[model samples]
Structures are given as C-alpha cells and as structure tokens.
Target: MFVKITNAGGYQYVRLVENYRENGKVKQRVLFNFGRLDLLKNDPAFRNIVKKLSDIVERTTTDNTEAVTIESEEDVSDAVLKNWGYIVFRKLWEELEIDKFLKERATRGRKIKFDADKVSFLMTIQRLIEPMSKLRTYHEKNRYFGFEEDIDLNQLYRCLDFLDSIKEDLETYLYQRNRDLFKMVVDIVFYDVTTIYFESCRADGLRNFGFSKDNKINEVQVVLGLLVDKEGRPIGYELFSGNTIDSKTMVKILRKLKEKFSIDNIVIVADKGLNSRLNLKIIREAGYDYIVASRLKNASKEVLEEVFEQEGYKRLDEKSYLNAEEIYGDEFKYKVLERTNVIKDEEGKEFKIEENLIITYSSKRARKDKEDRERLVSKAKELLENKGSITALEKKGARRYLKKKSKTEEYELDEEAIKKDEKFDGYYAIQTSKKDMDVEEVLGAYHDLWKIEQSFRVMKSCLEIRPIYHFTESRIKGHFVICFLAFLLQRTLEYILRKKGKEISSERIMEAIDSMNFIEIEIKGKKYLIKQRTEGGAIDILNVMKIKGPKNFMTYEEGLGFIGINK
Candidate 1:
C-alpha cells in the first residue's frame, strides 16, 4: 500500500493506494480516502497516528536491539492499560489489618463460597477511588491492574451481609487498633450527626422521613451518628431510624462508644443542633463534659440584655480595626457570661451545671452574616411577590421571616423579625461546662468541629454514601460500614502525610491514585509492562509507603510483584 494525493471536488485529499496483479497485468486502486489533507492535519486522531508512527519507528530501532517487540502501532493499541493506583491503598488496607479481621470472621461462619475479605476490599477500594453501586463495582473489577473477576455481583452483596453481621466487632477492633498503634486521642472527641437520604420515597423500619440535614424533606433517610477523636480520627459510628432527632442520638452514641471502647475522661464537643437542656443533663449525669454552641437567637430577654453589655468584652487584636470606612467598633471581641442551671436526670434529682457562654464578635463574621441575611431577604421578597395560594405557616429559612397578617391567612415580610435576626448577626455564643479552661481553648475546641463536618462531606460527596438503593436494613447499614472504612483509610493516609509534612488532601490523593496507570503489552510470547510517569502526590504516598517508584519499563513478573499480587 502507498499514500497518494489527489484532487476531488476542488479539494486536495489523501488516499491509500494498493497495488496487485490480477490476470497478467498489474493494476492500482485507491483503498481508502482520508478526507481533506488540511483538515486531516488538524485532526487530533490523525496527529496521534503520526506521533505513534514516529514513536514506534524509534522504539523498534531502540527495542528490537534487545528483544522482538512492538510489531506495529496497532500492537501498541492492542495492549491493555489499567489503573494500578490501588497499590497505595492496598498497602494501607493491609496495614490496618482489615483483611485479617474479615478472614477470621469468615472462618467462624458457615462454609461460604466466595471470599468476603476480597469482596470487602474491592468495595472499600472502589469507595475510595470511585464510588459506585455494588453491581457496578463488580463489573469494574477489570479496571484495576491486579484485580480479578473471581467474585460476581452476588458475592459483593453477600459480603455486605457478612459485614453487617460483624459490624460491631469490626468497629471495636478498629478502635482498639487505633488506640494501641496511633495513640488515638479519646480525652476529648467531637460527635456529630448527618442524614443520608435515599432516592426512593418508600419507607422501612430503619428508613423513614425525618428532619433531613441535607434538606431532603421528601426522601427517606437514615441518621448517621459519627464520633471522632480530638484529631478527627474516627472512633465509631451508629445508624438510627430516619425519624431520630440529632440531639437524641448524642447521648446514646457517647454512652455506648465510651463503654465499648473504655474511653476515659472523654469530653464531647458538638454544634447547637445537639445542644439541648435534656442532652446536656444526660451527658453530665453520665460523667461526660460537653462544649456545645448556644443559640444566641434563642436567648431570653434578660439573657440578651446581659449578653449585649460592653463592660467585660475584650479585644483579641487590633487587626479588626477599620480606618474611615466603618462606623461602630469592628474589632473582634469576646465576653464570657457565667450562669448556673439545674439539670435533672430520670430520678428527678437535680444538680447545678456551671457554664461559661463565650460570646464572640468579628467584623469578618459580621460581613458574612449581613450577606447571608440579605440573600434570605432577597429570597423572602420574591416569595412574598409570588405567594399565590401557598400558605406561609412560618416554615424554615426565609419562610420564618414571613408572618401571617392578624388572624387572616395572608402573609408578609415581618420587619420586626428581620430586625431581631439582624441584631444577633456577627455574634456567636458557645456554651461550655469547662469554666476553668481559657477562652481560646474553648473556642479552639468548638472550631475543630469543622473537621468532623468535613468528614461528613467526605462520606457524602467523595464516598457517595447517600441516595441509597438498598431495600434491606442490613444492606443499608453494611453500605455505611464500607463507606466508613473507606473514609478511615483516606483520613489515615492524610494523617500520615500530615505527620510527614506533606499535608495533602483526599481529593488530591484520589487524583494521584487515578493517574498511576500501567500498560501491559505482549512481546513475541512473553508479557512486559510499561508505566506512565507520574508527578503528583502519588509520589509522596509511594515514598511514605516505602515502595520503589515505578520504572518506565518492567517485566511481567516485576509488574505483578509491584502490584503485590503474589503475596
């Protein structure tokens, strides 16, 4: 075959001409026409073809000197390429001893056909790298270099069932391991709750409609109560019915986690959502201290009168001062209001609970408060203008600002309510039982609550924990267990990096894992592996794991060894 340039319809075209002898005479015919030459030159695929041709020719000269390899560029296209980035996570998984735990459980149960440990590993790794449904994860087994298709979709489901069976054991095992190995901090832990909603509206014993943190009012969901140590390392988690209130789950989680793990002198920290008179009483009665945010908007008339006093407030720094552009004092200030309240247990016995409500104000927080209020106001006015037949019954968000006129059903923006809300802007109050602790310590503990919140984001977004499709309660709980393990592994890697001075993110770690691809090519009869060079946080991870960097070229045995397939 030969390439020939010809003109057709006033356009220059490239053609593949093949020559052959039929009877006694030789004849030539065009085999294929590659459209216009100019367009073909600009096409990416064509450019790739040219580059591949150039590369193979150079390689044939270079590689043929050592072995019979790479017959053509088509051979290169026929080679298998897959993500081997999981090698990093695999090491971490084994180090956590999850494999040993699952295998031991498998031995205790009836003789199962499939490997629960392997399937669980598959699902957890999928949750870390790219979360998907169980059936989808089964189908994507070949997407990894060392992964095999020994287990089917049914096996993955069975693994979840087994995981549900040993959920508590697994949690306890991890808690003990972390405490012993990492010196996991339990002196003070942060606990928070978030709702994971399902796609279907069908309710079950465990899944029902509740006050969704996700604002998924129409969807059925299950509340997840997560407990993390001071450093944000997960201690354990619990799943409650969708109707379970966030505040109600607090005492239950704290009490159980403490008893199960033998946590000592644990002080719990949480947001205002879990801050209630009853919760505080139960916590105190259980011999645990709590630092929770107090709702400044819910203050009584006398409390507000005392909170707004300027006599005891202190400025942290002069950085908040404004020159010529602001009115009142914009410096960040804080004041502690001490109060004693009697909290009673189930026995009707009352005890005095002393608390220091740390009230803080800042110009930056003031700006954000104003912006958020204006946004709500904008949405409120639009709601009023379009308030056709919708009954405004003082609902959440902007609707709370809409008051009904007198006894009539008609609604309008309540200026008084707006003014009252604005008065609390830039002001934040934290109620803590630790009266002896300094102000900065109290604020610092409250601020670390974001780490637990960030963990929820990791579960919801990165791990895709919601929109659950499982109908059975065990499956739902098991799915959460898998997601929790994935999140733990990711956080463990991040913690390792933080200690090593890298300070990488989970998203970046995922990207780095994704970029570690390897090409498996067959040369003559033997196979060879070629790794694509990577320059990302994956390098840091591989180094931290004490593994050699992937070479440009490796034998099949070396590739399998590198992926840790043999042992």
Candidate 2:
C-alpha cells in the first residue's frame, strides 16, 4: 500500500493504493482516497490518518521485499509524550454512578456552549484529583487526557451557578444512590461540624467573624455540618453561618434529617461541644436517641463521688479497664451510673429524664494533665516572682493556681485548686439516652465518632475545603457542595477497600491514584497509551478496587474506554 499523489488543474489529490503483481505485471488498486493533499496536509486529523496509512504501506513493502532488520533509535518515529493519572479516579467515578447521575440531573440546553453534565463531571473529577481553580483546570486541560478540551472558564463559572441551583436535588439523588448501592442504614447517624474560613476580610450574611476552627479569627468563615453513616460514608450536610454555635446547628440538622430524609429513630453521636441541655432535649423531643460526650469536671459532686466509689469495673484490655480499682500506665477505666436530671419542656413544665452516664478515666490522660498543670503553674510562679501585673494572667485564668493573700498583696500557690484539678484528670463522661445499652456498647459507639472527625480532616487537609476563594454566597455553597461530593466519593472508595479487607487510607489511595499514569506515544498518526506500572500502595488499591492494572499498550480510544469514556 502507498500514497499516490497527483496534480491536475491546479489541484493536488492524494490516494492510498495497494500494489500487487497480477499476471507478471505490477498493478495498483485504490484503497482509500484522501482528497486535496494540500488541504489534507493542513488538517491535523487528516494528516495523522495519512501518516498512519503510509506507515502501514512502508511496513508491508519492507516485510514482503527485504529481510527484516531491527530499526535503530533514529529510524523509529515514535516519541513518548504526555502522561495522565486521573483514569483510575475516573473509573471509580463511573463505578459510583456519578457520571450517569449528573447526566440525568444536570440540565443541558442547546444554546449552551458546553455540556453542563460534562463540565460538572470534570469539575468533580478535578476536585478529587487535582482541586485547582476553574481557570487552571481549563489551562491545564491537556494534562488530564484532554477531558476538558471543550470547557472554557466562562462555561465553568456558569456550570457552578447551575450546580448551585440544583445542589439540593443533586444531594438527594446522591444519597439515594449511595444508600441503594451500599445498603447503608440510617439507624445510627454520626453528626459533626467544622469551620471553613474564607480568605476575604469582607463578611457576608453567611460568612461572619465568629469562632474559627482554623484559627483565622480575623477572616470570615462558615460552619459546615456533615452527617455520615456508621461506616463513615457521608449521608448529608448543612451549611450555616460561621457565627452559628455548634449546639444551635443541631436543631436544623435534626429537622432536615426528619423532614427531608425521613430519617428518625437515629442515635446521634457527637463530641462534648454539641452536648447541651437544650440540644439533648431537642434530640429527645425529636424521638431520637443520643450518645454525646460530657465534661467530667462539670458532674455534680454526688455523681463524682459515686463514680469514684463504684466497683465491679470490667477490664476492657491489658491497658484498659471498666470499673477496675487499680490504675496502670495508660489504663482506661469506666463506671456506668444513672443520672436523673430535671428539665423544662417547651410549655415550661418540669420533668425528669433518666440518663446513663459513662465516666471514663485514663492513666495516660492523668500524666498529660499533670504535665500541663505543672507548666501552667510554672508560668504562674514566674508571674508571681517577677511581681508582674497579675491582671493579665488573672483574666486569662492561667493564674488559677495563684492565690492572693487575704490581708496582704502577696500571692501564693493555690494548692487546693491544683488538688481539685488533679482529681478530675484522665476522667471524662459520656451520656446516652439508650438506657438499655451496656457501658461497653455506648463507649464503643461513641468511639466511632472519630470516623466523622476523620471525615472532617479529609475535607480540610486532603480536599482543602478551607481558605475558600469564592466570595459570593451561592458560589461558596457550591464550592462546599463540590467538596462534599468529593468527600462522599472518597469515603465510599475507602469503604469499599475496607470491605475487601484492604486496610488502606484515603490519603494513601489518593497518592496511588495520582501516581498511576499512562505514557502516550504517537507514531504514524496512531496514538498509543502504555500504562505505566504503579508503585507503592497503588497495586493493592487497584486490586481491591477492582480496577484493571496497567496493560503493556493500547490505542488512545481503547484507553478512553478503560475509563468509561468513548470518543
């Protein structure tokens, strides 16, 4: 086969022909016609096609006419080029049905410059893989296997606007999809809140100067409340103003759960920050149970005495105990006691709610508390010795160990205060409305709260959900929505890996996915992608995630098919 070029009437024509010997005569038959070689040469697609055909012809002629010989490096026209690693994540996204869901939920209009669903899909994939600005995502489109080739910056901004408009519906759809696919249950819901701050100093109604978990008190912030199942998969989320207190946000979250999701009869697990009398009452009135941590030092004297005197503590392990008398290094001990608290309802009627309190003590916590107190006392002594103004330390409460002499201006160490703090060291309390649950069961359930905390860490550190650049309220919400979806997918992947007995972390998996790339080479107009061997935990990740490992080589189209993309 060869390309036969002909010029006639100031027009150049190119035809692909196959040469053969018929009846001892050399003859050629046209295989393909590439019209107007001048025009075809300027068109990259057509030029690549012609080059591929020419290479095939040359190889065929060489094989038929001469002895085969290895080609030198210079003779090879192939060069390894671009590399992309997002294919694994893209595959996982498809497996999670995100692409299908977006296609169905996102509205596409004929007048739009780009596919809305495609843009949203790319944004989400980028959020999980790279997490860059929209403009950067467009500028670096080629780095991601040309997935965003058609998407522009303006289209991306509009896409976020559209995404914000459909955020609620999209979240509902994702929740249902995840529930059906993972068989997720809502019996036990873990709820927690984190603060994401904005870089801008300007505060909007949604972003206000309040408690900043990131310690950016000067900057505006917002509160993000996330709810997850027992397996740490995100169920839903709510965004509130930064000034909103953690306790105040629970009512809204519970209402959403009951009204929107129709999920009641759940046992909410949270940290001590959300454990308020009002929050507890709200939980009970909503017909739900709660296992919340409580401040041990705040316990009534009678309850504290009872905890100290209680017996029959079961030993949980070698380093932990439940109601044991002796305390060892890092020894954990717990005592279950019933507490009757009087509370007023909305009608202001007084009533008593009997709740079980699990007081836990740890020797490790004791040592840490002692060391912290000593440091604080040292600071206090320095202030006293220097006769420095005590007002500052007194206001900050670090001078609790320093007592002023009743009749004199002198100050001395408050041995009594130090003893009081020492007694409560290594002791914390957990209160639960599940009276029927044993101490061990309640403690274990509360321990799972760390999963939700871990989810927050993933969002803040891995997803970089904080320091948001978007200033508009809708865009800010949309930003969080994207991060939330990213976190959901990540948690789902982690859940699957765990189910398969692969104890890999989301961070490690992300690193592996990022490192898994393909080497692309173009020769004779044919583009080939060779999957590079993955290193580190990527191997086990691919196996457990059911993703195919790298093959030796495949065509570009075949590579696209591997990631559930065609054309």
Candidate 3:
C-alpha cells in the first residue's frame, strides 16, 4: 500500500491505495480518502494523519507480513526457542532454484506421508551449517525457524533414497542451472579422486577396505571422483568402491560427463596419480583431451637427460603470472619437451601418441627438496644407532634410505640413492594432449587443480560428508548428493560475493552464519520474534544480498519473510 494523489474536476485529493492481483490481473483500489490534497498540504493536517496511522499500526495492523496466526496458544510453547541462520542461505537457495526443483519432484511424484521438499532442504541446510546424523537432524528440527513441518526419522531416511533415485537427473539440472546463473564455462574440468572412510571395519561391495588416505587401514572406505569446472564450482561427482585405484576411477566419471551431462569437447586436468596408459587411451578413444602431471621420476634415462638439459630451458618472465613478481621470483623457469609416447588400450594394444611435456624448475622447490631429503637422512642416521629395532614389518618411508652391508646386518646410509634422488629436485613436469596450448595456458590450467583440492577440504571439514552412518548404498549415495548440493550453494554464494568485490572463505561464511541469533516470544496471544545480538559479518552479508535488516521485535510472519516464505 502507498499514498497517491488523485486529480478530478481540476482539483486534487489525498488517497491511500493498494495494488492486488485478481483473476490473474493487477488492479488498484483506493483504501482510504484522506480529504483534499490542498487541506492535507497544510502542515498540521498532514502531521496529524501520519501520527494517527503510526499509532494504529502498533495496535491493530494485521497483514501477511505483520502477523501469521497460529492454530492455538499451545503452538506458542513450541516456537523456535533459540537461533536461526537461514535468512541469507534461503536467498541463495531460491536463487539456485533448489526449492522449486524439489517442490516439483515432491508434487509430481506419488503422494507420501511427509513433506519431501522441506525434508530435503532441512538435510541440506544442516549439512551446510552444522553437520550431524540424520537421526540427530530429525531430533533437532525445531531449532531452526522454518522447519515446522511434521516429520520423523523414517521420512528423513527415505528422503535420501528419494535423492538417490534422481541423482543423475539432479546433477544434470544443477549443471545447467549453474551455467545459466553464473555464466560458468565447463569446457575445462579438473578430475581428482580421494578416499572417504567409514568408522567401521565391516566391508560391503561398495565400502570394502582399500588404501586409506587417512591411514585408517583397518576401516572400510569409498573412493570418490569429483569433477569441477575451472572456478571450482562442482559439475558432478561419482562414487567408487573402497579399493578402486586412482587410474581406474577416471573412466566412470568420464562416462558421467559425456553420457549424463552431455559435455563434449572438454579437457580433463588431473595430477600424476590418475595418469595411467589405459585411462589416457580410454579418454582419447572417447574424444576428450587431458592435462595430467607427469611421472618424472619413472622417465627413461634419455628423457630425463632431455628434461634436465640446459639448452632448451627458458626462464619464466614476469608476465607468466597475473601477480607474477609477488607469486614467483626470477628463479622460477620452465621448458617444454615434445616426444612420441606409447599408450596401451584396454585390449593391451600399444599406439604411438604425440605429446608435449612441460618441465618447470624453481630454486625454492630445490631448497625444500634438499631439506626434506636431509630430514629423511637424519632419520636414517638415528636408525643406525639402533639396528636391532628396525624390523621388516615396520614400513616407515624413511627406512628406504638405509642400506645393509652385504655380509652382515649392519646398516649404513645409501649415499648413491640419495645422490640419485637429488638430481630430480626443483623440476616438475606436466603432460598434455593439447599440444597447441601455450605453455602459460597449460601451466595456468594445471595450477588451478588446487581449487578442486580446496573443494575436497571444504567438503571433508566444513560439510563433514564422510564417515557414512547409513548402511544402504542408496542412502549413502543420497547422503553424498545432499552434501554435494550444499557445497554447490556455498560455492555459488562465495562466487556471487566475489563478483561484488567481497572475498570470504567457506570457513568464515559458516562462522558468521552460526553467530546469527534469534528467539521467539509471546505478547498478548500473538507470537513475535525477539532478535538477539548477531555477531561477525551478518549485516554485511544481508547488505550484499539486498535484504532488509530484521527488526529488533518482529512478527513471526516477518521472520518467515526473511526466508522467502509467505502465508
């Protein structure tokens, strides 16, 4: 509602009007006529009317935002007694259209006993802020302001299965949405694998024990292959068995990108761990390109000589990096060596492949490498003092630098092995199928691989996606899907803030959000929200999103409005 001036018969009158929708049409109605505009223009008349309305609003105003009536006084006893942080996140949630997508799925599917959309959102927001077990989330649902839906533990468990049923479709939808929303370019994707371990030692087909990156050898684990776009926004992800090797995890994710997402003509960037011959052949056969770290230590002697040769090495100039002088000094340099390499396919047939190998050197890397070897050699010397305790069963890495005398068991430091290892220090190499790409572009694409690694850290620490408590495979998949979507929202928020010239990490975002506080109180049989002190950057976050600040005392409806809900 707003004030308007109406002109009729060559005169003007003051009017209060409202715009409403009726029968799919917008119409305006004059709510009140406040006498002639000439009279109201007199200072006293205008002041009196304004004061009267202001007085009436506190006592009698009732609108969708002013009040949301509860069923009875008993419901007031169960109002949100503590805090909520969904105001900013819900805005992001709606921007990504997750609520709309889930609503469509819920309404279109067979009817169920629970609110599927609300339940799905509850899981996602919980993972985003404070991760916990599904049962725990169900038990604590009333803590958040908007989760008044009647739900139980079984419904939460079932939602995971619901999510699993639409995993591929959901990924496809998110990819398209992210592209449209952020103008994200998915042409170059980074693929890397990590192991997510379970707390239990028991093994299932999918959760069998394998090499644990966490060093939990006795526990079961699952291998996760994550594919992210250039800026670290997730495109899609795949789950593999616990024992699946890194090289073997590539094919399935590649198939997902091609078949599920319909992404064609893209380059997959990865580290040396996934650079197996068979994986490369499969990628080439499927018509995709790659940029993977090279296994320089295992290279043939001739190739190693060419890599270390001084003739072809070109020093990296200041133009190599955007913040070149600040990031890399004059000691950083690189050289690209081209060669015909052999690749083996699934059928064991070898084919000649032309590739450009990028080799880089840094004085800083050499110094660090020297210190690391000296540290290991120092450990080897410490072991020489106690040869009896060095057992074959103990597989510590530092033990490899020790050499035993041929006739006796006395151990001595292997100078030859240490010297041989020193030759490759300060040098790094990257192999790429796109030979036409400039050295800087190749280096830039390969350097951005850390974004994916940072993403993994965000999920494992901030999202807590691992330690699968669900026994069923579908629920496990669903759990990951929930966390993955939450990550997508978090990253999207970060990206938007970055565009606005505000930089924040996932850790700081969660910190500020968790510090937001509020409580519910009853006054004259009407429930209202009493906002507590909000800490950190809560106001800054809202300002960036263009949301109005919450009043110190607001109706429950107003609180709901902050989360994009209306009666």
Candidate 4:
C-alpha cells in the first residue's frame, strides 16, 4: 500500500492512499486529518511532515522529560534547645541574660562545675519521666546512642545527680530573672496552686500532702504555686504542702511576691475559690487592687434583693470589642452588662441563671456595677418557677422525719433538705476591673485562663508529666521543674506559631523533632554520607519555621556547618 499527502485546510489534513480488492476489482483510498483521514503511517506522510520541526523536537526532549533525583543529605546534628522556634523565649533569655545571671547567683555560694547550661543531668530526670519502654525501644532500634563513646547508659543516671544539685539554684535564678526583667508592674500577677504526686517517700519542708490536683487521693503530693504574667511567662512561684488551702496559701505566696518584687501597684486576679471576705480585706488592706470572681449565690438575702431590684447598671451581652485602653489600666470605666444562661434538663425543664458583668472603670465602675447588680437578682428571679429561698434556713436534724417505701430502704427528709440546699450551685458572676473594657476584652481574659487548663493537658499527654514515680520530695519537685521547662519550651514554640498565624501544636513540634532521622551511607570513596529524613509534617513545619534544608547528602564538613559546630 502507498500513501500520498493532500491538502492543508488552513488547518491541515493528511490523506491516506490505500489499495485493496473490492468486489473482485482493484480500489484505492485516501484519508485526511479532517476525519478518518487523520491516520498517518501509522503513515510516513506525518513523520516526513514533522521532520522539519527541529526546534520543537529539541524543546520537547528537553522540557517533557529529564532525569532528576531528590536526595537528602544529613550530617551530625544535636537537638540544641535554642532555635528559630523559641524567638520570644530566646529574647526573654537574652533580656534576663540567664547564663550570666545564673553565674552571678551561683557566686553567692560555692563554685559549681556545671550550672545552668550544663543541663544534661537535669535532662536525665526528664527521661525517667518518659513512658518506660518507649525511649528504650527507640534507642534499641536506632542504635545511635552507642555510636559515641561517652554516651553510655550510666551517663544518664550521672546526669540526673548533676541535675539534682542545681535544680534549686535554677529555680531561684528563674525567680530573680522574673523580678529583674519580666514581671508586669502594672497588672496583678494571677497566682494559683496545684499539686503533683510522686511514688517516693522522701519528705521535705514544702512537699507535704494536701489536696492533689492529680486526683491521687491516697498518694502524698507536693503543692505547686505558679504566678504568671499576663503574657504567660512564669514570673514567680512557690512550693507548699499538699494540704494547704488554695486561698490561704495564695495570700502567703502573694505576700512573699509583695516583699520580693516590692511593686505595690498590683491588682490580684483570682477565682471565687480565692475570694474569701478575709482574703479580700487582706489584699485591700495591703493596698492592692482586686478583681475576684464573686460567689453571687453566697451574698446576703437583702444584698441579693437589692441587686435584683436596682435598675441603673448596663449589662452587656455580646463578644468584646474594646480597644487597648480598656485592658491595661484602672482609668477605664467598667461597662456593666448582664449575662444570662438557659439551663435545660433532659426532660425539657429549663432554668435561667442571670448574672452581672461588673467591669471596673478606674473607680467609678464598681458603683455602677453595684447599682446594676441590685437589679440583676430581681430579673433573674422572674425566670425562677419558685423563688423559694435559694438559701437554706435551718439545720437538718431539728425536726424533719423520713419514711421509706420498703423497710430495707430508709431515707430521711432532713438529708433531702441538706441536698436541696446544695442544688443552686455553680459560678454566677463574671466581673472585670476595667469598666471601659469591651465585653469581649473582659471575656477574653477569662478565656486566657483556659491556657492553664491546656497546660495541664500537655503535662499529662505530650510531656508524660504524671504518674508519680519518685516518692522523695526533692525528686518530685525536680521532676516537675524539668516538666515546667519542657512546658516552657513547648509553649514557646506554640507562641511563635500563634504569632505567625501558623496552626500547629506542641505535640506535633516535639514529634517532628523526635522523628528526625539521620543515617550513614557508604560509597567506594573516602567520603562519608549522612542521610537525614523526616516526617512530611516535619519538613512543612521547618519550612514554616524558615529552616533551610540541605540540598544533598551532607558530608561531615557540611553537616557541622549546618549546626554551627566544629571539631
């Protein structure tokens, strides 16, 4: 069969010439690009037509396909704590000049071989807090630990002792740093106490058992008081007995803070649990402003009646939109707004809990709040089906008797009365010291309180900060101290991500760090090849964090350059 080229239709067409026998006669065919004629040798016409396209073929060969490889090069690397992730923390560390400060503080006593930066010993204690088989299994599989002569298993325990000696000095130095560089002079430090449990038996002056936040009712735990600035940098803290009352201990801690920092322009912010009348008077007498969540249900009946009947306060019922002035000082007026909640039972019974938003405006907001609260109770009661005394009037055992449907199940009305008194429970009032603070600003501070809640979650989940293994007081304190540092590191990373508007978590960051793997590759040459690979997320986070990745398998010389290390 032979084919011939035909015409170009402005557009082009290839005519195919075919020879065949049809009905015992010789026949010929032609094809064009317009329809079925588009076939070419498979036709020589198309190839010969396109051979003139030298530039196009060269371009197609170059652009359509090329050999490429993405190879990761790795060098010796260490997980140095200082990095792009902790910008603010590094700034704070610089501001405090932690190394020099710790050295200066250490000079007050004896000379120590290793101090703040030689924290490998302290880091050992942190490892013990890890889940038992996880790290062990990790090292066994990785075979990386024994690669260095000095990093034997015993080195871990030795480091723990080193950490043990310097732990107190570390904390003392941190406290000094806060006072010298980081404390908020204008805002009251929000201080609260919690307890951590340990398995060991060693006791000290402070780690006595009281109420354990860890829910280890039978285990003896040590109390921990943390005072943080508005920005969440820990400013000061104290270790107390586990059994101490939250408010009583809070006052003692505050008094110490008062003496140490010596700043009187402070306003204490705490929950209702710390708002005892005695505590309030003590703080007030000490000349500090106070913004405590009030137990409105505990108010005197007459006071509550007045609050309900009065009608001058404005209750805001929306998110905050206050400018910066409302948050930082007392000069702003409290904008009184009422907040209401509708509680519904499983069976469709509904109840309304009406509360007042008492924001303090310089000094006038409080009076306005008082006026509004006088009206709040009456409005709240209007929603109550029976405004029967929310308060209990009598003792349980004086007169009430009880009967049971069966003799086996005896119940008393007095017990029922006591239970009834406990029913109207739950926090009621949401107040702020700044009246000019927008509704959202007032609510936002309350929301910031949730950071502590999340810190607890990280402590338990990501950091493995619980399930007390040490029974001794010092070790327990040391355990939490390291955890606190880890928490600091974690939050620092989180803060950076937040400031950058990047959505990532502490666990993910740590996981990224831990997941980073380095390997050794051998070639028939004197060159050593180190291969580093990471989880996909790690690469993404590193990119977001602005860390440049190595282009090829990095040699020892190149890897050392990456980490700023030299032999």
* lDDT digits (tens) for residues 1-567 of candidate 4: 243455556433443344657799987643112123444335332343233222222343466442121121121121111111222233334454655654564456744444433243225223322333223522432232111223434433333444456665665566665555533243646656667666644555655556667767666666666766555555556667767777776666667657765666665667776766566556655666555576665655654554444355443332232343344323332335555434454567655434345533222344454454434434333423333432342322222223232564322333453343333222145544444545555555654665555655666677776566655455555556656665654555565566677667766766555544333322222222233344435666555556665433444455446543210
Ranked by lDDT, the better of candidates 2 and 4 is: 2
User: 1 or 2: which has the higher lDDT?
Assistant: 1
Q: What residue pairs are clashing in model 2? A: 313-322, 313-323, 314-322
Q: After the best TM-score superposition of candidate 4, give how far the Cα of residue 90 lies from its true spot, in angstroms.
A: 9.0
lDDT scores in order:
0.78, 0.74, 0.78, 0.48
Q: TM-score for model 3?
A: 0.83
Candidate 2 residue 32 C-alpha distance from true site, Å: 32
68-124 in candidate 1: lDDT tens per residue? 433332333234557888877787778888889888889995677788778998899
TM-score of each: 0.86, 0.79, 0.83, 0.57
Model 3: CA > 4 A from native: 1-84, 107-111, 325-330, 393-396, 523-526, 565-567
lDDT against true structure, model 1:
0.78
How does candidate 1 fare on TM-score? Answer: 0.86
How many steric clashes between backbone atoms does each model show? 0, 3, 0, 41
Locate the minimum summed-lDDT window of 10 residues in model 3.
70-79
lDDT of 1 at 98: 86
Candidate 2's TM-score? 0.79
TM-score pick, better of 1 and 2: 1
lDDT of 3 by residue, 297-366 (tens): 8998888888778888876555664344343444777888888889766678888778898888877778
**lDDT of candidate 3?**
0.78
Candidate 1: the clashing residue pairs are: none
